[model samples]
Target: MIHMAVTPKDRSHIRTYKTAKQAWERLEKLFLGNESIQSSRFEEVNNAANNFVMLEGETAEEVHRRLTALALQLTELGATFADDAWIKRKFFTALLPYEEMKSGARESRELIRLLWPTETLPTDLANLIKWLETAPDRFIDWKESAARAGADMALSFVLSWYDEVNLDQLECRRADVEENLPAENKTARLARACAIADFVDKRVFIEDPNPPSDDEEELEDEEIEMESPPPAVDPAGPPPAGA
Candidate 1:
């Protein structure tokens, strides 16, 4: 059965072992070694998280997708972080120069309110990306607001470093509005917030920000091979004489 299970090329390796146990041990070593190498590869992908930043022309969805891919890779490699909240936090932080939005609410909720205040914010990461992609008008307004407010030195600095909206004391204003809300309205608002959290699993795990196409993958693979060190040659083999 084992012989039948292995590929033809691997059959020779099995035959070289005298007993089934030996063959199994050898196979384990080979596969285990490959897994170790893959773990190192995951570490490389995780290291990439440190370098992630929202590019000038890129949307938040694009950035989220890219970071999601890295996070997924980490998960696949048996590396687990604290929770989805941590993953969401990591991605938010990774969007460097765009400091966390000033809303005391969770980042995802704040993002939802920023992009689509009227609609129900989807709890899933993919859905959120879809939502952002579909709303060009909202994005235009967002960009314009940023540009207009960005002219002020203090606002510009805050927007660039914290990546927060220049709301001009929006938090205080929000408190004032909440304070004036009727008792029934406030209860409804609290219920809505709870529903949103429940709908979105507190926060969704981000996935590949920019999944590569086949052609891109090929190019990346070629680049990786080119960058890799050449294999060591046998010391006892041939030696080149002085030219």
Candidate 2:
């Protein structure tokens, strides 16, 4: 015989309803009743809530199936919460099965490109390489911070794969580390990087407008348009760098 440990709350919540609908109603009420009650023991409360919801639905067999699906979805969410890479990889994984389905990769790639043009391949990959060339070694400098930041190892791994495959570069760079991050994680990091890049590009790098020359006034009168020069790279180039 096996004995299992049960919490007092769990025991108390164990209830039976004559009809499935009644059980569902009770389940909803119980969940709503305790939602504000936060505690470290959240898992226990969640389990009870879920169990009650299952019991209130369909036939026992169907209940089991629904519960299993719910469990799987929760597990995926849990993994994603724990690691950034999981979420990132999950996105790429979702796109994988369709890769062979009659230009599925093309369609997905196009959609993603439109959705996140700045972070899309070729361009993003090129910038990442430039970033890694100088960014500090985050693994050495930010081990604790990275973990606390919820940065996922899987995300790093995915980015690295991108760097390795895309640039065909063997050595790891700061951008390489970024690339090694999973797709989702890379998106976050890249968004940050892009923001910084834009700021630097606009404020620090872009040349100040030239004061209008006496000739310029004459040119303007003549309707001769002058184009501004592109932004300048710093003598040392982009930011100091980061992992």
Candidate 3:
């Protein structure tokens, strides 16, 4: 009989989820052969994290960081921030690529693009978008570039937008809105807020009040005609008619 060597499970593999749900599924699979995990709470956290990301606009990285932090905070796991490299590798790497794509998509807000044209956009934001659009291809000729540098380029493009625009902060606000609503009632809260804000913004612009209705102007003209003194008609007009 031939004996085969088996690969040991590592922390690196446990953190590859885009949402907590995904992570939970992977964790369940990983722990299937082990005796730990007394109940379904492990799975529940993953589900909550997924909900947080989907409805709250929280990034997977944020969720992963939160989960890891909570774990360490409560001492649920031996994992510490010091060993976060694996978390970054498994979660952020996978999540950021998706986030970068999303960030790029978000830049397509037509009104914002029109109101803040790229031709006149602040140098920092314009340059950032340009680099993002061109990506590592523009830097292909650089000397001794590594194979994975292109991914770094994508990450840099997204990170630059996030850092400069503070997308995480916006996401935190989005999360707040989601938090205030019950799961059943959280439907479209983000969209509704955006819509209401946009509507109010449009309403702020005062139009010329419909140019003062034509009927009102005509009535004012009639009033002025009646108010003016009658022409010296009498004596001169009778004499001209007789002639």
Write one digit per residue (lDDT tens) for candidate 3, span 179-232. 567865655645554444442323122224335599997999899999999877
Q: Please give each candidate's TM-score.
A: 0.27, 0.14, 0.22
Which of the numbered candidates is closest to the native, going by highest lDDT?
1
Q: Which residues of candidate 3, in runs, are more than 4 Å off?
A: 1-37, 46-65, 70-83, 90-98, 106-243
lDDT of 1: 0.64
lDDT of 1 by residue, 1-243 (tens): 677889875675577677888988866754566767977777687677666677766777887787677775565455667247756887677665554432322575666676765667777657766765666866665565443333333344456777657576644555577778899998986776545434332122222445679999899989999999999989887776872
Please list the C-alpha lDDT of all candidates, in the order they appear.
0.64, 0.44, 0.48
In candidate 2, which residue ranges exceed 4 Å CA deviation? 1-81, 104-243
Better of 1 and 2 by lDDT: 1
Cα-lDDT of candidate 2 = 0.44
Better of 2 and 3 by TM-score: 3
Q: Candidates ranked by lDDT, best first?
A: 1, 3, 2
lDDT of model 2 at position 70: 45
